[model samples]
Target: MSTQPAAERETVLIRSARDVTELVNSGAARGSHAKMIVLLALGGIFLDAYDLTSLAYGITQIREEFGLSPAGAGAVTASISVGAILGAWLGGVLVDRLGRYRVFMADMLFFVVSAIGCALAPNAEVLIVFRFLMGIGVGMDIPVAMAFLAEFSRLRGKGSKGSRTASWSPAWYVATSGCYLVILALYFLLPDSQHDLLWRFTVGFGAVPAIVILLVRNKYMNESPSWAANQGDLERAARILRDSYGVDAVVAEDAERPKRESKPRASLHQFRTLFARRFRPRTFQALAVALAQTFSYNAVAYGLPIIIASLLGQGDLNTISASLVLNLVFAVTGGLLGMRLANSAGAWRMTFWGFAVQLTALVVLAVIGDPSSTAWVLLALFALGGFMFAQGGGPGANFMNFASLSYPTELRGTGIGFNQGTLRVGSTLSLFFFPVLSASFGTGVFWVIAAAPLLGMVALLAKRWEPVGYDADAVEHEYQQRLATPEPARG
Candidate 1:
């Protein structure tokens, strides 16, 4: 080793796009930077969870106000997700083409504006339109935000223990818990006199937080180092590492001849390369995880307040509010533990066990199928709690983590966005179909929900892939090399 410090050595240099990640993975040195990325991702997801979950609590009131039929109500609820599918695909393209920080600011503005529009809407039609608009923002945020977190996670130093991508689990649980808490408070504070206005206020309340997030983001947000380097701006990437992430990266004189250990930059056509035979299976794994998690969770978790009201007796707000509180507590608790465990055990382990927990819950609910019985109702609540606990720690949090982390930096945004798009498909399906199914089948609806997790389990067993400690650049490079050779690549 040279006697001079790496930072002071004039000959030191960044050779490839991976150099950005190498420095970032330096751990605590990237604390404020990583924290900022985490906070941004957390805020974006929080707004999404709040906006998406808040509607569940308000739908009854909203239905009453708009005189909606079951089909209409379902359509309205699913509309946001419908818009999200398109937004996610488009957002991924934009982030890769335009930039992360640019898309980040614009998406928040979408949420802020749509929240206001939803609050002031005079009819169900108008509210649905705005919610759809808001969904675009929600959809767009995931790819960039998750990409930001995954890229910043850096695999070196302290972060070597657990990927920074793990922060998303706890952040999302906080958002869900926060939504329940806010809804609970709204229920208590608003009297019967203001019952009709309650949903509007609660939904619109999201705007204030969005504004606060905007302010913090304006001053602090910076482009992803890997992205900058990928765009052939190594100097800017180095500055970002040193200034924003506390990494003192220095470019060696022989940067043109990169150290053999450094991963070379990938071509710009990386997004198109995702569908190749080698990557197709991994893509399927990501889609399966996202779709399964969203479809199952949206059916029960999003509709918990309504489910609680119906099970415990519908007239009193206290019972509904209490159930919401309890459900969120369990979810947040489970999410925190899962977040901790995912870092240590890997996301694949969490997803496998998570499905197992949900499977048991669904089966028990199916067997004890009488909501009329007090004991059965209580058991249902316990089962619900158990399922949420597993979800928070397992697939709910890791779906995006895997999507964002599994791909090369060039394709990370597109990969996560693709996952979000699939998630929206599941969300729209469940949100639209669940109310109708529940109306006809009652708690028997859970037997169907159970099928989603079961499929996830089967896929996991058959595919047998894991992303923990994955090497995105090397993996992509290896795939490319295999393609160049005569034979196909195989494990």
Candidate 2:
């Protein structure tokens, strides 16, 4: 190695992965490239939310078309959740092993192909198969999307990592609302004779955005600089910083390579690391939040039209209008407010309060039973709107915050993957049972839904871990420090 001056090297060189991480953490990079990356990642999330909600209004139509029993309808509805369970579990590991760029690109094709297949399916069995494939696409996108959001942002202040991660909430609601708008448009535009094609058109439209995102992703998407550095590829990390973050980082030729973690490529052992002593509390909280949030959110959001129609004894047009208003006004608004407050109020507090509000809303709905009058119907609507508002702003947004922020870059994918995979189990159960439960129990199903947020509140009280404003990359910094310090000589 040529003898470079130590002082000069200190000033100009990125000596370790920690150096790159520090540059990112300091919020030095202010470039359009960074913003583009975040927008693209949000696009992926938008696709996930859109695809999931596309069939919400069409589920009854699908049942009628196929002459399906309740159990058969549940199967068709729950198929995606089943597929998502596998996708999240496997995708989480793959994103870590393969890098976010590769996995993200690959998952988009899943959306396109699955959407087309679902649109063309001739039978109920075939439709279920395509929906399962769509679920996989949805499941795979989340971990990678969350990774891109967290890695691209700074640790604190406005548009901080926490706030950026929470932005997924608004993106999701916006997409859900977008789905309803599409359905509403089709409701009026399609001829009466072609009304049977509504479900097909709605399901197929999901592919259009997926195709658009896929085309643009290649030009703008770059490997996460932190993920590049974590893999001991300082040269690649430096290039990414220069291109994406507007930082001209220099990697000295003679610098020692940053030590990589000994963790094996995505496996059960890798999953075990999430529950190791240091990460156990975080993992528990993440699972609790995800399980509670998804169980309730899926049940309520998927069944929104049914709930509205049942409450008001309204026709399809009225149900669609009510659902759209609830999503746009309450859900989307709450999500935006949550993102704004994430930096100041903290995720733990917001999530806890969100669960408390949802718990109360569900309890009120349970107490009210079925609405017999217009005023009672408004009260029921208010309760449902309250639950959506709380969910959008609180737990729905912050669950990803917990999954993505609680772990260092090395384990971020696996932590999010494990958490998401477990949560999908709850999602599957809720989707499969919600219709059955509502049919069997009538308005009493609200009491059952109340249990989800109550469980979340209990877990939050039990293990209080706040991921907001915490520096996950500090572990890397500490590791670099330990390496720099000389070992004590043997006595």
Candidate 3:
């Protein structure tokens, strides 16, 4: 059963379900481990948000300094998202192969190194390269954090209930807004001659959270017990639950969990398993939703500062700061709404309505507003930020669930990874194209951009099914049974 010798001590008892209930509801469950995991997981998101917003704020300054054309500026802007696409794919594979804790730790280390590299870059080329490297860390961390959040949040902590995984990512946005606030404060404090260091300091400050979390990771972090269970090490899984979160999960006497028939253990095989017929619908759903949302969100929501600065006909830092503050307010509100609905309405439902509302708001903005005129621009941004709240709260919650539910426990990280990876791809495309589109199409670009989520709404309405109340084990069992005994073809 346990690979360790019989004489080795067990960390916590794994006797019964009642003990699990007790442990999950206990004070310790909320105090150290849960809080630590959530805070650590948010680190990458904070960096991602801060970098995008700060870079957007500094874009005009950077472009003038580097003598960059709009296209050249866009390239620097798009670099991180491009790198994130590759990083998410690589990180997903590594997480499935090396284990979640290891890959997560490695990702944080990458952030620290990348942040310093980004700060020290001498030119646009070097900045792009460094930003891409930083993106790799950003890409990998989102899905891993989701996986961590899904597992950690499930154990009904004090007043914390079922699968409110969406709330997890939004916490990082709060951290992100904090970064923007810091940068804004620095702008007010420093003289105009020192502007170059402003962006550098913002990027540099991102690594602090990562370093702080990495140091304490081993002291409190726990591996996913469900993931261990999927690997057939029920005893080890049980041990993790008991020791890490103080949960008392029962391990069978044999100390091995049952496996799906013909399950594959290799990483490549695990990747393929995600696309198995049983999983294809959900996989597609995850991909579509992740892709559409990133395209829309980054193009508009994170792009708010730039959009607002342009409309105001003012290049002042104060203008950008005010817009960002508004965006953060909506983001937090959206996150709270999504967290509240994630369990009650079902992930797909929340995601669908969220996207629908976002689309409606975007269309309203396109219909009533003009970017070239300063008068209506602030109103457009308010609508943009308001819609963003739904996006973050609604789809933000949904993506974690989508990532977590689209595969068996053994490959949960892969599911989350691939979905986030797909989102990064979409974000990269938006990053590269949105500027071109906006420059060429002007106000018409908003209307055209709204189509992405309209398609998402259609996709969800056509194919999405409820997963909230569905037990993972039951789904796997029934899916396997249907596969084994095919029904005769009807004439």
Candidate 4:
């Protein structure tokens, strides 16, 4: 018997985590369980953000310390991005196959070891290896965190979970600004005499946050009821609900319902299932958005400060301060706009407009080329600002939303993983190529960067499904129904 429902209505039999999920989704249950899970997720995201941007802050210092060339610099910088691609792929399989708890806590160790390794590297080769290791932790964290948040958060017409997921985008902004702040503080505190150690400190500082996430996650985490349900363990699902959320659930008396079908088997051919027609569209849509968003973001947004510094012939110190302020304003404004507009503007609409804005900005930047005059520099800055605002609010906010909403819990981790993995692939390619091309092409690099969003537009054109406020259970059920019903053979 249901604790609250027993007195009011006939007690509904509890099923898998799916049933518990319905309770939470229906507002029948509410408590610290969901909120705490979101906190744990946020902590992971915070570190994910921190580790990403911290490298850029120290790029120049690392370059000089190791006597590296641009090619070497790109390789060292992109090492983490490449590692993330691998980690994300593994996370997709691991989180879904091994339970979220196992993968979630274990990856933090990668961050600690990699951070320390980067800080203490004897040579560029060692730094690259460690960065690659750290990248794996960063890559694995997103799918695990996103899947957990998607499964657990209370969402109604774009509720906390969606907000929490959207909050992940701003983590980039937070990371960018935080790195700058750290770098600035270090510069002032250490004086010119000790500034040589700045890069090491910045790279190492990320461990503090990763350790915090690992610690808090220890106390507040819960096994996902939905994931439990997906595994067909109804009792464990019910117990988790009652124990963690205080929702007393009972097994249903009868197994008959008007249109019930068995839950999909927890099969291991995740990649194959994804390509099946029923799921292919959803997979493509999520993957497209992720690839485009990362391509645009890494190509322009991540490297913006470096580009600016190069144009002005400003030293690392000035670049840090300038990019930091720019990112703070951009992050707050764009991230706020994305959150405020998520429900009203809708996701696909934002994605469309985001790509358009980035494309326009890139074109303008190309035309302006490297900023020789003050006027040209300001104009290019304005264009960059437009791209950032549009991206943070649009694709940046919506890509992960699409990834989170695309599939059922059974494949959700893998689904998000594919999105994230492909995302890092795009990011890694962009990060690697952007500098090489930038050096060769100067402002023409914007023209090249502009091409990514154009491809994103092609992906968006492939199909349009706006999933901002839709329930994951309902979405999954709808897919199941389609799978149940036979369709006419196509000519």
TM-score of each: 0.90, 0.94, 0.86, 0.90
Which candidate do you rate higher for TM-score, 1 or 3?
A: 1
Select the stronger candidate by lDDT from 1 and 4.
4
Candidate 2 vs candidate 4: the lDDT winner is 2
* Model 2, C-alpha of 281: deviation from truth (Å): 1.0
Residue 73 Cα positional deviation in candidate 3, in Å, after optimal superposition: 1.5
| Regions of model 2 farther than 4 Å from truth | 1-12, 258-263, 476-491
Ordering by lDDT: 2, 4, 1, 3
Q: Residue 317 of candidate 1: its Cα lDDT?
A: 62
Model 2, residue 82: what's the lDDT? 92
Question: Which lDDT values do the candidates have, in the order given?
Answer: 0.76, 0.87, 0.69, 0.77
* True lDDT of residue 146, candidate 3: 68
- The C-alpha local distance difference test score for the whole of candidate 3 amounts to 0.69
Using TM-score as the measure, which candidate wins? Answer: 2
Question: For residues 1-491, could you state the per-residue lDDT of candidate 3 as single tens digits?
Answer: 66542213333443433233334333333335656666566665666666656576666667777888879888888898888888888787777666678878888888888888877778989989988888888888876776666555543332242354566647756765786787788887888899778878877777887788788887877676555555555576667765665444456453323463444653777678788877888888878877777788888865666666663344666565665576578877778777776666777888888888889878977786555565566677677776878787777657666766556555677777777777887888788777677777666777977988897788788786765544454467567679889799999
Candidate 3: worst 10 consecutive residues by lDDT? 16-25
What is the per-residue lDDT of model 4 for residues 1-491, given as tens digits with 9 covering 90 to 100?
46555312444467444566677666555557667877677678777777777777677677888898888988987999999999998888888877787788888788888888988999999988999998899889888888877776666555555665776767667776787899889988887977889888988988887787777775577778777766666666666666556666666655222221354433457877888876788788888788878987887766766788775456767677767767788754787678667777777888888888889988998898767787887788778788888888888887888888767778888888888888898899888877788778877778778888898888888888877777767777777679889999999
Task: Report the error of model 2 at residue 320, Å.
Answer: 0.8
Backbone clash pairs for candidate 2 read none
Model 1: per-residue Cα lDDT over 189-269, one tens digit each: 888788678778878988988898888875577888878877766777777777666656766555544332343333335
